[model samples]
Target: MKRIRMIIAAAFLLIVAPLVFSCDTTEKKVPYFIINVKLDQLTYPVSSTNKLYAVFFVNFNWTTPWLNLSSSRLQIITPPLNIGDFPLFFIVFYDADNSGTLNSGDIFQGWDGVIVSGNNLTPIIVPETEMMLLNVDLDNNGIVP
Candidate 1:
């Protein structure tokens, strides 16, 4: 009778141990921002070869990976931004030369005075509800204007 009671207690412990021990306790913290892009007024004819990319400047600079320009609406997820109010000169361009660098004849536009305020409290957030309209019709002139 004692042996049977011991076996039942061991079985209960085995089942409950995994349930309590398998819970995830450690969470990695990463903060980021999302920018929704609107290209409705883009006059340049985008094609499969034309890849889209974005870059922003604060005290330094940050860039996004080249994205396929497959739709009029797009999203750019920024890398982890530390706490600060960074004034951004946001530029989005098509890599028309396919050289993986900004050059002349690549159609693009920019938004000046865009501010990205980042904090460590949240993992992801959108800074604004209005989509950034791309219609300025700027291009790389191989010289700073």
Candidate 2:
């Protein structure tokens, strides 16, 4: 069968390629990464006035290779930030007045958390994903700027 033949060939490549390449002792040096965060598309805005104040936010767990033995913590961030070493990332897109600081006025927001591996993935292959946050404000107090 054609399918059977294809499977056998795939198995052969999988088995043989590693053996061929594994013999090389040279270590590979992988560079760090750069990321961009953005926000949009959420129905919950405390008020139209405050919705204008929201801004995007991000948090990333950074390591020099996630495989490294030591552990670390997540670093929250916004756009225009350059990250180095082994950067594992998650994105938060927010909407609130000032856009600089999250306040009582932020009515609606969107969020998505995904991991970005610096060593395993490359800049070209990395895609910037957007976030949509929930509207947590029940009272209408967020209207102030």
Candidate 3:
């Protein structure tokens, strides 16, 4: 009788052990912000000009405060100007959720048209309120506002 009782107890533990260990304990998604920026247009001179015009759109994601709960720094880059005025490239920086979706109220605007004699790249920072409208070509698809 004792042997049978011991076998039954062992079988019960084998089944319950896996169930207890398989329980998952993970963290949930918290509130956060995301910055979405898009270039709108680029106008350059036909002659040897070092200056160009850029238009862009900046959207913000300020619904909640989760990760990176602070103001972020923005950076913009463009192709090297050889002769005539040309458009440049631009991108923003911010923390994203696990699903790779940028939050609301986190967008910002920027411009990239400061010419330097050397091979130095200059980034222009736009004010938060004034950044609502951007003027630049981001995807290089020739789209403007």
Candidate 4:
């Protein structure tokens, strides 16, 4: 009788194991924010080759920035980004660079400090605005002429 009970228990476990360990088959969709930046009014510098790029300042003044993309003459549309664990915010930099270094530029339009989350999203709009520029001479010696 003891041997018969053990066999029965083993067979029952084998039948129930797969059901207990089964996982959901559905894939979850991630939420994202839509950022719209209009750049029709920007003034191209004299030396500018008219090259423009768009910068994403992830998480509100984060010291490290995300990848910047080449911008059209009119606007930039961002891909969906998953929300971070901490406070969520974003800024867009409409970048105009004449110095060849895409980062160092003579004109910048900064759209700063936007809290992005929740279902009722308002398309974050960044209108054209003249922003402070950083002129960087990466290879120039410390001596100033």
Residue pairs with clashing backbones, model 1: none
**Order by lDDT, highest first:** 1, 4, 2, 3
Put down candidate 4 lDDT per residue, 24-93, tens digits, no spaces: 6754433343334433452432223554444554444433456565544334444544432333333344
Instruction: Between candidates 1 and 2, name the one with more favorable lDDT.
Output: 1
- lDDT values for all models: 0.47, 0.33, 0.32, 0.40
- What lDDT tens digits, residue by residue, belong to model 3 across residues 34-134? 23334322422111122122222222222222222122222233222231222222323222222223334222223353222122233334322212344
TM-score computed on alpha carbons, candidate 1: 0.39
* Shift in Å, residue 30, candidate 3: 5.9
With candidate 1 superimposed using the best TM-score fit, by how many Å does residue 48's alpha carbon deviate from the native? 6.7
Give the per-residue Cα lDDT of candidate 3 at 75: 24
Worst 10-residue lDDT window, candidate 2: 66-75
Report the error of model 3 at residue 33, Å: 4.6
Q: Residue 127 in model 2: shift from native, Å?
A: 8.9
Please say which candidate is ahead in TM-score: 2 or 4.
4
Per-model clash counts, in order, read: 0, 10, 19, 0
User: What lDDT does candidate 3 reach at residue 84?
Assistant: 21
